[model samples]
Target: MGRILDQPYDVNLQVTAVLSKLSLLPHPHLHEYLLDPYISLAPGCRSLFSVIVRVVGDLMLRIHRIPEFTPKLLLVRKRLLGLEPEGINIDHVTLLEGVIVLEEFCKELAAIAFVKYHAAASSSP
Candidate 1:
């Protein structure tokens, strides 16, 4: 004996088919991230984060870009800051959050770069 189909398909397959029919709404932030270098954490904070994220994203994109680094970074953040996930979709939220954190990391690196720049300038005398 076999179960009857709702519309000549398996229930799970039908659900997935229906879900797949739904379209992703276009996100301006994501589009801006792709197109504009100026659209970032802050004006001075832009270049450093942009370069780092672009490099990382480029490397990851070569392997299909699963966005796994976001969660891993969040895990590192949790360990360092004792933060915890707030909701069910924490993984998705971590993507944007991780970018912001990486931006801050880059900003610190930029500070180091600035110090190096000043040191070189002073030493050239």
Candidate 2:
């Protein structure tokens, strides 16, 4: 197969389009199918895959505000970036924990938005 950078934009666009609204669906039976390829790519492609995942995650977060999906999305991030057990280094553990904390932060923001937007709107006359 060709390298990720060879067609980064197209791949990013396609993956983003397919996955952006995935959080709205039930948990997929096979998760991150599109991402499997990136994990096995050369190290140089990792950064490009990271960007692709970030874009997809951002789109999901912004559009859905489903706090439950945060961790799953980050897991995909960790996997695609080789931060999972098979590829993980001791030094990367802290990085993984930092990301989990960031996911918690995003969930808190979503909760805040629900209270400020949905709850407030519903309470109004």
Candidate 3:
């Protein structure tokens, strides 16, 4: 697996693909209900989609105890980094740091999952 900064193009492409797939899944239609198509038609829609996918993916991973979503979280962190401005507002820096913390936490969870999985495999008959 590649680090978020190491393979940004691949990460963004994968995240976009996953989100596109998720959009097809059956669920309450958030875009239709909450977002106006006119507003959503602009570049803001892509930013909104990225945020939604990142958040939903993180919550699902945590709820299900799945480690595979670590990379997705990293991808989101990368996206947030790109959105940061040159002047570096304190609030923005704090938010970016929060995202980094979340990514690191996810990585730790993934490491634990790897260890558990290996232990279980080794102990199995």
Summed backbone clashes in each candidate are 0, 0, 0
Which segments of model 3 are wrong by more than 4 Å?
1-91
Instruction: Please list all clashing residue pairs in model 2, or write none if there are none.
Output: none
* lDDT string, candidate 3, 1-125, tens digits: 12222234445446544544443333435423222223345544444334444664654444344343455444545555685334532322332334454455445434544654576589999
Question: What is the lDDT, from 0 to 100, of the residue 50 in candidate 3?
Answer: 47
Candidate 1: deviation at residue 54, Å? Answer: 2.5
Pick the winner on TM-score between candidates 1 and 2: 1
TM-score of every prediction relative to native: 0.32, 0.29, 0.32
Write one digit per residue (lDDT tens) for candidate 2, span 12-31.
34543444344223343222
Q: What is the alpha-carbon lDDT of model 3 when measured against the actual structure? A: 0.44
TM-score between model 2 and native: 0.29
Global lDDT scores for all candidate models: 0.43, 0.42, 0.44
Point out where model 1 deviates above 4 Å: 1-91
Residue pairs with colliding backbones in model 1 are none
